[model samples]
Target: MKKVIIIGAGLAGSYLATQLPQNYDITIITKASAQDSNSMLAQGGIAASLDPGDNPASHEADTLAAGQHRNKVAAVDQLVHEGPKLIQTLIKQGMPFDHQANGALDFGLEGAHSHHRILHAKGDRTGLALTTFVQSQIEHVHWQENTTAVELLVKNGTCYGVRVRHDPTGTFKTLTADAVVLATGGLGNLFPLTTNDATITGDGIAIAARAGAKMADMAFMQFHPTLLSLHGKCFGLISEAVRGAGAILVDENNTPIMAAVPKKDLAPRDVVARHLTWWRAAGHQTFLDISAIPDFPKRFPGITANLDRHHVPFRTTNRIPIQPGAHFMMGGVQADLAAQTSIKRLFAIGEVACNGVHGANRLASNSLLDCLVSAEEATKVIAALEPAVTPALPQDPTTIVPPKLPSLADLRQAAWHNLGVERTKAQLHDFHTWLAQFNYRDLVPTQLSPKDFTIANLCLCAELIDTAALKEPKSIGAHYIKEVAHESTAS
Candidate 1:
């Protein structure tokens, strides 16, 4: 049996593991425990064409609209067309989906969607439910918890395996395999205010880039309009589904802030979040009023429990404090439709792979769909590739540079201020200069501790974002410039 090594045991890895041919053996590795993935913390449901009168073409059009038509038309077609059938497969396998009182499947609507086509489980706990549901079916695959990949084992222009360290015992070992799959989540933890799993530090992307894998759209990140603002590294999220359910964004005086936008509360996330960003500058605090949803507590048990614990009121007309926070990444290591990266025998899926499905901005709930679709497509390709018996191991690489105790918190704070919901060239340039003092490009591909390697990668990821952001003079989707597109055109 050919052995495949999969890094990051989140939805993409777990789901892809189940999709491979029976003759193949699998090894799924995680940075920490299985629960430390962003997939396990997702709030909104997976979007699909599952409702009556809904179809893949409509879903495709809506997805294109949300992404501002910057999405790859081919990739979006695959996700929209194949996603429903995969959802049905899961449903038939006894996966529980929310149902209406009439026993019909209760499809939910979210930002920028033309129809209510999101399939959720247990309300806002779709991430938790989906990851858990997929993980439950694992049988023969070897699982490695508390293990972190320090580097991709690339030699002769092809990746053969990974060099990882078991955090529990600090044991470093090489896991050779026929193919390597990277499903590491996103870079939310790199920001001060985020709804991403803290364990996500862009390790997968960094390692792939160092191995010469092509990366794209490194600057396009989506900020959720309503993460519960808090003074913690990781904040809670108030799902956008609240607005889709008729909730409204309000000021302290209860005036609707989104009144000027098209579709009002249902405007695309980029527009709504940009509005809220400026609204905050004008002195009125923002909140989401879900009074229209009478059975809010019963429908969203996870959200209600969180709000109650934080002393937030959930009654009619009362508001829950909301602010934009680092939510999702729309770009990553570039991958083809089959999930194959530029590097031979190396694949990237999930949030870590910028496969062009998201384009400039990601549509709500499409991430889970992207995960399943990318994995299924990649599995078909991986099944046909023959595994190499063994390849020449890498020569010993060494770097003697001393570790710099970089302040991660300070970097995150700076990124949020300059590269958050809005940006300008001046801020990005200033940030770039400050960040350049810690550049360690020459020291990579050598022996470095996990903390050192992560700091290096975060700096690299930050530079990529700043450089790309500075180059784009026109505002588009989630990436907003202080100057409008017409102003740039006039200049």
Candidate 2:
């Protein structure tokens, strides 16, 4: 039987695994416990055009607008057109979406959107709910939790499989297959302060880029404006839906600062995040005040509960301090509409793949939709290929040993310092120079290690991010240039 290996057991990988033919021997490698991913951390709902008054065109329009017109039109069209069907599939698989009195889907709205088209589950745990449901339904799939894919085992321009390390056993193993799918999530964790899970260190993008896949738009990152401010560091995310639901962004004086913006509380994420950053730099504390919101508990129980856990009571608290945190990467492994990368026998999906559906910035809640649609599309493409003869698995040589690499924490700090939030030509140029001088020769050991692979990927991703940021002189989306005196200066 032909085998398929999937890296990362997050929403995209898990869903894609389930969609593949049961006859194929499938193995899913997860870096940590199966649930440790940005997908599970997503509290906001998935955007879908299921409303009678809404359609794919509106969804596409909103996504394009949020992406700053840099999104790939064809890819966005496919995602929007296929969104409703995927939502139905998830619903049919026992996803408990919020329902109206008549048993219809209860939709919510977010910024840069013209329609109330986001679908949620109980309160704000839609992603968790969907992931749980998908996990339960995956009957025949083999899951290797706590396993990390260290490198793509490619030879002669075709990907054969991966070298992985099983964390629990501390044993390295080769998992070969007919195809490989890269679903590892975004690079948000590269920043010191982000809402993403710690495992999101741009692993998939880095691996693919090193394996010769084209990368796009690495410069565009999306910062969520309302990450909850904690005493020492920000941890929890304050959902944008709070603003969509009438909560206001106010300064220390409790006056709404976004009141004059055209979209008011409904501006795109980049606009809001930039505004919040500016507010903080000007010696003002930004707050999201939802105390006056009626039935706030029932409406945003997830956010309320999370805040309460942190000893901040949202029900009575008049103001919650806010700041922009590195949230989403708008760039990733370059892929076509079918999720096919430049390399043969490899596919990229979810936040790891720059399908261009998101462009320079992703629309709120459109992420989950991209996962579902792209998984289905990629699976279909994978299914159409005739199975190539199983090449003899590459033998591991006793003489070969894997290279030693930097610790994850060190890499995280390095990336965050140089590439977080804002940039400058000189900073990027210096970063490029420093990166060139860094010794990657130490990364090549005779044998491969997962940590080694992860570090290698991190360096590659950092380089790509720096290179892209330097190339795109104009500040757009989440990319801001501090040294640019005027917006027109770059143009």
In terms of lDDT, the best-performing candidate is 1
Question: Can you write out model 1's per-residue Cα lDDT over 148-221, one digit (the tens) per residue?
Answer: 98789888778899988888777788889889999998888778888887789988988887788888887789
Relative to the true structure, how large is the alpha-carbon lDDT of every model? Answer: 0.85, 0.81
Clashes of each: 0, 4
For residues 284-402, what per-residue lDDT tens digits would candidate 2 score against the true structure? 88889886678877888888788788887655666777787889988998888888888888899999999999987789999988988888899888888777555766554566444
Candidate 1 lands at a TM-score of: 0.96
What would the TM-scores of all predictions be?
Answer: 0.96, 0.93
Error of 2 at 399 (Å): 8.5
Clashing pairs in 2: 401-446, 401-447, 402-447, 403-445
lDDT of 2: 0.81
Q: Which candidate is the best by TM-score?
A: 1
